[model samples]
Target: MNGIDITVSTRLIQGLTNLSLGHVIMILVGGVLIYLAIAKEYEPVLLLPIGIGAILANIPVTGMTEPDGVFGILYNIGIKNELFPLLIFIGVGAMCDFGPLLERPYTVLLGAAAQFGIFGTLMLATLMGFKINDAAAIGIIGSADGPTSIYVAAALAPDLLAPIAVAAYSYMSLVPIIQPPIIKALTTEAERAVPMPYTNNQPVSKWLKIVFPIVVTLVCGLIAPLSAPLIGMLMLGNLLREAGVVPRLSNTAQNELINIVTLFLGLTIGSTMTAGKFLQWETLGILGMGLVAFALDTVAGLSFGKALSILTRGKVNPLIGACGISAFPMSARVISRLGLEANPNNFLIMHAMASNTAGQIGSVMAGGAILALLAR
Candidate 1:
């Protein structure tokens, strides 16, 4: 009886003995993410799964992150091959309405100009002693596009993906909080009050809608060959939406497909946040630098918008320029709200959406350029 009791005690206490402070800390961190998701509603779809994965990853002797474990297999099948982000882009493309951009063609320049933050942060990261590849991955956080950030980081700096992913999504959600101050600080009362009436109500050409995505894919692929996969998938999704012939496929891409992929991607990314990999000084640096990258992108966009306003003699509202990041309709809505606050009659959602859509294409191009130049 005594011998049996000793054996049972040892076996039962094994897990407790193996537990470490790091694991406890990581679990607590996961709890925080979960709390934020549930209480604050910040990216609940991704953050909730990410938080759960983080907790599971830190459990002693689970082997969930082992090479043959579920997370490991998912990571290899979905993330390592870069399949998940591309698929998400298809859904994003399907959901996007390019009519706003087509009607206001010049907003494309705002998107291109917004990419300056990416390059600017790249230089800054390089100067701060990071490798060129890591620097490039870090710079892409400025794009404010989570999937692009993940795609670039996984290819260039797989080790840094955890923090980069967190930063990208967290900051993307905080666009309303982060961008408003910058936009206000950069523009004066008159600039904020500037209103551009939406007088263009002509129907867009159906043929142009069908052909636009094809032309964009071809041109972008020729310009940056590596970006072909990312842009091609995006264009394909948009074509499905615009082609008006594949309602079932388009609906699937927009709804079921994206939701499933997002769940898997979030879980896999979170599982990578193990104590050994995630709890480091470098993680702090990545988070800090990511905020800077976002701020820089906003400043660059707003500056270009102001300049464009000056060149056009105030016909173009500078507020639309701030929507140039890939945060999409959130940024556009922010601009619209601010515009209305400045002047009750100001309606900028249409104009802001034009710039927002352009930013989506711009972010993908920037990611492709990085891959083209840096990928081994």
Candidate 2:
């Protein structure tokens, strides 16, 4: 009976014995993520699962990170071959409404301009002694698009995936907090007050919506064959949304598919944040540089918006340029709110949505461009 008691006690203490300072720190980090999600309402869907995964990963003897374990299996099947991010893109594309973008074609330029941060940060990362591949992956965090960041990092710098993903999603949630001050500092009151015309009178044709995806896929694939998987899947989702006859398919892609994929992807990514990998000077550098990348993207977009406002003789609201980050409705909403705050008559939501959607495509293009240039 005493032997049995001792054996049970030893087994119970095994986890405590193996726990390290690093594990404690990581667990606390996980708790912080959870707090942020629940209390701050910062991307609860994504962060909650991630936080739970991180806590589970730190616990000793769970066997969850083993070769055939859940994390390992998810990592191999979804992340290793770049399947999950691509799947998520399909859902994102389905959720995107390209009508505004089609109506205001010039906003695509804002999206393109926003992508300058990815390259700018890449050069800086290389100068900071990151390998070309790692720098490229790290630079992609500037895309401000989580799936793009994940897709690029998974391909180029799997080791840095956890930090990159966390930075990407965290900053995305903080768009309202991070972008406003920059937008205010960059533009004058007159610029922010500038009102642009929005015409819902001329609805984009159904045919155009359906055709845009196909043409984009064809052109983008040809220009960057390496991006075919990324762009193709995205366009496919958009096509499903636009097809009009496939509501079931589109709804499934938008809701069920995306939700499931996000859960698994976030958790799997969190599981990778083992203390051995996460607690390092390099991890700190990646986090800092990611903020730099995000700021650069916003700055570039605003600068271009200012230029466009100048060239167009105030016909374009420079404030809309801030929407060119790929945080979707959030960035658009931020720009719209800022516009309203500056000038109540200024209704910039549609215009901002145009730029926001353009940013989405631009981010994917930027990722494809990186893959094309460096993944070889």
Candidate 3:
């Protein structure tokens, strides 16, 4: 009986039931992601869960993402149905202070100008022989908005979602390393030194704050009905913040609610990066285009800023223009720091934040346009 039990156990560990080469490779990938998250301190909140999920997913015959499994349930309920990303948007909206964007309307123009990277990359992807929908999904990495990227890819090209998402988040976390070099290469010392004073001295009436989101929702809904869910959820979150009647709800949305969704979001996105899905020559192309897209966005944003600086008699620093991607305060901080480096007294955070906020809206708006044109 003992011998028979040993034989049965041996058979259990054999065959495809055990680790395959692909599974091993994927586990290693998962480990690398975890290492980056822990050791390098890169996007730890998202990356940690993602790495753990990837490893869990690659185990042989685990059925962890099967119809009834935790991952499967998460994907079906959150990602596949496109609910979690929108919920996270609510959190994002709640955290943002749009006063800066409101103060400087022209920075909205900088936000619009920076979006050329999306289309420019689309053209490049087309020339590389990607299908139109595939190219559109790939091009949106330039928007530097991971949730938006995931939404577009899930709709237009679900197959490319893994690489597109990984690329988007990776670049987002590397903003400090990537953006400064581009800004420096594009601007002269004098241009960087140009101080952009906070011009919006008028107090933002609380009434206008409440009204702004409602107006934006109506406009976005009319122009791009498909984007209504995205725009609506985002506006609702902002309304919760600006309305000031529900501090309890606002705090919940900003903290606990968003935190939970983000953990699931990261894990689900990572699970999609199985070896079979991610290991491809096409994946390489997507990664390459992602980098190019970000670089182009920075360059285009800075160029527009320089034009504004010239037009406004150096009153607008070109450094603020570099903040015209959807990376939020990080991008703004980069430009502000660069400005300070050029001159100790050049405090440009509020000015750069104006463009950064505008970029967030511009990115979502651009996503709306894509949905209108591409979604059938």
Model 1 residue 62 distance off true place after TM-score fit, in angstroms: 0.2
Candidate 1 backbone overlaps, count: 0
Model 3 over residues 163-226: C-alpha lDDT tens digits? 8887888888888988999889888899898876665578788888899889888987898787
Q: Which stretches of candidate 2 lie over 4 Å from their true place?
A: 1-9
Q: Candidate 2 lDDT, tens digit per residue, 91-122? A: 99999999999998899889989888899999
| lDDT accuracy of residue 268 in candidate 3 | 89
Between which residue pairs do clashes occur in model 2?
Answer: none
Candidate 1 ranges beyond 4 A from true positions: 1-11
After TM-score superposition, what is the CA distance of residue 279 in candidate 3 from its true location, in Å?
A: 1.1
> lDDT for each of the candidates?
0.92, 0.92, 0.86
Of candidates 3 and 2, the better by lDDT: 2
Candidate 3 lDDT (Cα, 0 to 1): 0.86
What are the per-model C-alpha RMSD values against the true structure? 1.5, 1.4, 1.9
lDDT (tens digit, per residue) of candidate 1 on 73-183: 999999899999999999999999989899989999899888887888999999998899988999999989989999999999999998999899988888899999988
- The lDDT, on a scale of 0 to 1, for candidate 2 is 0.92
TM-scores, all candidates, are 0.97, 0.97, 0.95
